[model samples]
Structure formats: structure tokens, C-alpha cells
Target: MQNQSFLAMEDPLDALCHHFSLTKALLPPNARIPPTFDMTLSAPPSRQPTHLFAILPPEDNARVPTLMIPVSAGLYGQSFAADLLPAGTALPVPHIQNGNGAQPPCVTLPVVPVSAPHSLSIPLVLLFGLGLETDRNLLAQRMLPAQVIGEFPHFPAMVGVMAKLPEQQFEWYLGYTHGMWKNVLALAPKDAGLVEFVQMAHKVIVEAGRLRGRR
Candidate 1:
């Protein structure tokens, strides 16, 4: 319950794991840190700064980012024959690459709030935010194997930031974005464990997908 007890922890993350009273959350990837959101899917995704870390929930794994969760993801960027998509299908969810990451992307998820036994015992806390930014970048199914991203419907949408707070509703542009860290120290060291980080990232993805508009 005190920093004194956490001082003996060999790994800060382990201490984090201990603080959370978790078992499977150990050895998380990226030390439970999200990508710096610097450049887009392109460029190097350097590690950013943070004050919190969490384990990925069982709902997701490495290859599967979103577990078929549905959300009101605004309007469709493109139009496709209803038969091709047939609802509840895997989507190559487009990642919009525009401005440098400077603010948290605004988004929402449907999470059943739970009471944390160690909520008060844990010595640290972290808040997470996500953006619902997607590229109207279209890919037509009719094109088949030839045209990788044959144009579909194009909806011009900008990336916005939404953050998670204790007992609060998600609002857009309510958080900070990447390259925005000013005073916060890096939660994980340079050689932080990747296993736990990946696991933690899985949690973020799952949270973001909580309201996924489509598959």
C-alpha cells in the first residue's frame, strides 16, 4: 500500500502487476504502453511517455485487434453491396495519418465498470484515451485480387481524441495526443519487456473496439 513496499519490486511493471493483484497481466508487451502515435502506420512508432499500465483482457489476442464489437463509427466512408460485407465481417479498419500526434484521439467504449480491490492500495494510476480516426480510404470488394484499394465510398473524417475517466461519459477532443507528453516520465525503460506491453496494448485495442462501428 505504500511506495516503501513497491520499492522492493525488481520490475516496476511487476510492481504494477502486484498492485493490480493480477496473474495473467504479467510479462505484458511494450510494458503495457501504446505506440507513440507519432507517424501513421508508416514511420517508426517510437515509445511515448505515460504514468499508467494495464494488462490486455482475454477478449483479444495478437492478430485479432477488435473482437467483433460494434459501435456507431459515424458514417461509412464508402458504399458497398450489402451482400459483400454481410455485416459482422472482418474489416481492415483504416488508420488515418494526418497531423503529428499531439493530442489524445477522442473515442468511446462500452466497459462495465468494476470495483477494483486494489484501487486504493495501488500506488499509481493511469488514464487512457483513444481516437476514432479512420481513413475514408476505400477498398472495393468487387475489385478482388487486382486492385488492393479500389475506391469505394469516401467520407472525409478527421481524427479526434476521447479519454477514459472514472465514472464519466466519453467526449471527443477531451484528451491529449502523441508528441504531447511534456513532463510525464516514461513508464517502461528502453528495454522494457515486450510481452507485457503487447498484452497491455491488446487491452487498449479491445477498449477502442468496444464500440467498433462494424466488424
Candidate 2:
């Protein structure tokens, strides 16, 4: 489709809705943009500079920032405990007894508490990772409470870039605002809509960063 055709369309949302052959009922209420958060796995400080915008309040100034841990093994164990393990055997060694009478490897996680409507409780992505077993297990039962709407089990490496923000938001920018304009400039269509999208992404990054700063 040409840019002119898109511009000619009366409503961008309507145009998109029509393109997707979607019904009005299928659309989100008020066409709202969803909240975002970073879920990259816990990594060293060097990986954090890129996602400064993604940090939330309370977490913003964390001298020792929270690490994103990919709980791939943990998630798998939780999701399919019975099928993978022998009868009466539990894959989560500490939690269950293996039918073979052997203890499977287990990792302890840390738990942290958050107050309601608190800064860090704001919805965003969260990733899990495996680290050396420590007396301080940071793994909480739920990464966040029910109120938050972020994705879980995200990959850790993406922390250097977008981390846990919506994948759509991830693609719209480059490393940071410095690369924001250049990234958009390389778009294939080079249309006004594309420009608008990139600008929105840039705004989100700035806004999210500012929000973190406030906390």
C-alpha cells in the first residue's frame, strides 16, 4: 500500500481495523495504548544503560538494580511437573520427591514485597534467570501482583535494548533516543504513518524514563 492511500484514509485506527478485517467489537476500548515495562533477564550493570527508560519508580534509583532472571527451567518445571517426572517424582527437587528416590537439582528464589499502587508495581515485562544459588533467593511467587500487565519469562539479553517493553515498541526505536531518528530513517516505506509510529515510540521511551525518575 502507498503512503498516499494511508494518508487519504479518514481514520488511521479505522484503516488498520479494516485492513485486519476486524470487527469493532474486537478492538480495544477507546483504542487505548497499553502500559509497558522491561523484562530483560538480570545482567551486569553494563547491560542496563540502554533500558534506562524502562525502569519504574522505586526501581529507577536502585543503586543495585534488580536483575532479570530467565526462569526457563523454573517455568518449565511449574508448567509440566507431572508429565516430565516419574510417578511421585517432582522435577523441582526441593519441592517434590522423585519416584526414583533421588533428589533432582533445585534452585531457591528470592521474594520481595511491594505495596499497593507502589511505583515498582506499575505493569511491565519481567524475565527470569539462573544464577549461583544464594541464601538470598529473590524469586517471588508472582513477579508482580495481579494488577500489573507485563509479560513474564522474557529473555535476559534484550536488556541492552528494549528488555521487557511490548515487542511492537521494541522494533520502533534503536539503542536509545540518539539512535531513534536514524532507526526510523531506515524504514522501508518512509511514510508519514511510519514517522508517527517512531515518534510515538520515542515519546514512550522518554515518558517511561521520566516516570522512573519521578519515583
Candidate 3:
């Protein structure tokens, strides 16, 4: 059975292509094989979205650590900000409500010179929970300034720094992963490595941040 090369395959991309009978012709330079996942959303075909952008973890079969974002009209960037909305909040538990999600919290700090009685225009509450779950000092000093910077002067996803979030809260927080990617996609060139499995997985995080693969 050692000669049965199929089982010997370690690369998830190769396995995905082999199992799915995919053609690699005309593929980009990396020849990445999209991962296969089983999604059974009750949303009908017509209502189901057709565009998606994903960033996979480095390890093989890295679905568990993958990030998937929705793509609207083949555009996923700052220019497409209107398409990416904060469906809800994700702090203590997943409070996501699609169209009824919470806006960025309206901060009323003690005599702070920031905005007042006003939720942050950016959809950060849905993506990163108002940037106030933990790391009070760091977020106060860093995240808040970018978040309230006028609804998205650019995509404001700070994944590298948010690594300190709790596992479950962080996972649930993925509901807004799209907001993060769209911003990055807007600024990135089409061929600038943000396209495959994707070229910019390092540059963007997924909607759910659950890290699923595609095929």
C-alpha cells in the first residue's frame, strides 16, 4: 500500500485537487489547491452568496485556523465598504443578528475628548467588539483611534495584535471577518497575492476566523 501514492499525500491542496478531479491548467504561479468544506446553510441558492475570499493557515489541512470572507460583486476592498456591514457584536457570546447587529459601542468615558453618545462609525463592534473585550491599555492606545477614523478610511482589521483574544470569543467574533478583508482587498492589487488560497492570507483574516478550507 506504500506505493498507493494517494494515501501518501500530505499536502491538503494536492489532496483536494486529486479527490475533486480538479484541473491545474491556467492556475497562478503558486498552483494552490482550494480546500473543500461542507457548508449546509439553510439560505437558498438564490439567497446564498457566490463570491468569497479566504486566507488559510500555513499548515496542511489548516481549515481549523482558516479565515473566510464574503466577496460582493467581485470586489473586496475599501471601495466596496458599503457591501461589508457589521451584522452584530461578539463579546461575551455571539450576539450576531445579520441585519440587526449592534453598532460600535457608543463610548462615554469620563470626560474623554473623543466622540460622545456616538457609536463608532466603523463596524468594529461586529468585527472586534468595540475593541474593548480585553487588553484595555493596548486597545485604548492603539485600536480605538483607527476604529473611529471615519467609517473606514481603510479596512481596520488588526488580527496580529488581536491574537490575545480568548479562543471562543475570538472564534465567535469572526462574524465580521468580511469587514477586515474587504478593506485589505480594496487597497491590494488584483494579482498582489491576495487572490489565491489566498496570496494575502497574511494580509487579511476571514469572516468567521474559523479557518476553513475550500476546494
Candidate 4:
């Protein structure tokens, strides 16, 4: 794996051009475009790029900043003001496990409704990273709660795994949603054991759900 992260840190435009085929010539003249790393999730090969606009809150409506998001097919992006989540919702927090003084590996937060008469059709992308063995383990544990919550009505969500290749200096992302896995950018490592990890996650989640139901 070649580290591509350095490319962005050194010359972002060059990185974008090399990776996504985006170029300065594609933009308007005298555009003050800043360097940015495209972290948008992967989409199907047949999909086309789409523009997305943010839905701002009343307080920030006075000075809405120009935002550009590259969206793929079957995806929509929206934003809302921060507010309290519904009562009885479990808030994800870091918990020390096994009394080993080790911090929590992962935290799963609830995707609460932001608008009145909320629609569940909106797909939710859950972002996660794989860097350390602890992270993988934590991801397995956290996935159980994520799957459990996904069963609830009015929440359509999927897991997006972000794998950083320090050697390559770039990132790779894959998504699992609607009963399928999709690669966003580059392919994951053959030895990453992602399939085994996902299988074990599902098994543990099922067993945990069974135990909870027995209670």
C-alpha cells in the first residue's frame, strides 16, 4: 500500500486530481477553492454525482455559508440544529470494561429525529474506523447495539467502515447496509478479516439479543 495521505498534506489539488479526476480547470475562473479531502462514502459504479444542499436552522439562516457535497445515487444529505434526543433513548458513553482501566473501544449514539413528522426513509450512514486491534474488537462489541437499534422503526441506517492505510497514507471505506456490502473507494486488505469480523459481530448480536429477550 502506498501512502497517499502525504499527497494531500503537500498538495491537495494534486491529490484530488490524481484520485478523483477533479481538476482546477473544472471550476470557475478565479475560484478560491480550498484544499479538501473527499471523504464521501462510496456509491455504485453506475451512479452519477449529485449536488446536495444543507437545511440550516432558523438561528443560522441569516448567514448560510455555501456548502458543496458530492452525493452518489440513493443518498441524500440534510442538516438540522442540535437538540435533545427523545426520552428513554440510550446515550452512548465510554465505559471501562473488565475493570482493566482500558477505555471504551467504541461509542454508538442514537440518530434522533430533528424535524417534526420525521421520515424514516432517509438513510443513515454510521461512520467507523479500523486502525488498531482494539478498534476492531470495540467495533464488534458496538455493532451489537447498532444492530439492535437498527431493528427499531423510523431508523434506516448502515455501517460504513473507514480503514486507514498508514503505509499508503490514504483511507479506504466500505459500507454494509440494506443487507449488502459496498466498497466506497479502494478495496479493503485481503488479510483484514472483515468478513470474519462481520460474521462474529452478527453472531454476538444475535446471542445478546436472545439473552436480553430471556430476561
RMSD of each: 23.9, 21.8, 22.5, 20.9
Best by lDDT: 3
TM-score of 1: 0.17
Tens-digit lDDT string for candidate 4 (1-215): 42233131323223322232222112222333343222232222132322221212223233423222222212222221122233432323212122224532221112221221111111111112111122343333333343433443322222111111121221111112212122211112233455455544444333433443454
- Model 1, range 20-76, lDDT digits (tens) per residue? 222212223323333221211222222221112222323333332211111121211
Q: Write the per-residue lDDT of candidate 3 for residues 1-215, one digit (tens) a residue.
A: 11122213223223222222221111122334353222222222222222222333334333333333222222223333333322321112212122224432111111101111112212222112211122223222223223322332233344333343556644433423333344334433333322231223323344214333221
Ranking 1 against 2 by TM-score, winner: 2
What is the model-wide C-alpha lDDT for candidate 4?
0.26
Question: For each candidate, what TM-score against the reference?
Answer: 0.17, 0.20, 0.22, 0.22
Scored against the true structure, residue 24 in model 4 reaches a CA lDDT of 17
Clashes of each: 30, 18, 16, 7
How many steric overlaps does candidate 3 have?
A: 16
- Candidate 1: 10-residue stretch with minimal lDDT: 134-143
Better of 2 and 4 by TM-score: 4
Q: Lowest-scoring 10 consecutive residues by lDDT in candidate 3?
A: 107-116
Model 3's lDDT to the true fold?
A: 0.27
Model 1, C-alpha of 135: deviation from truth (Å) = 45
Regions more than 4 Å wrong, model 1: 1-4, 24-215
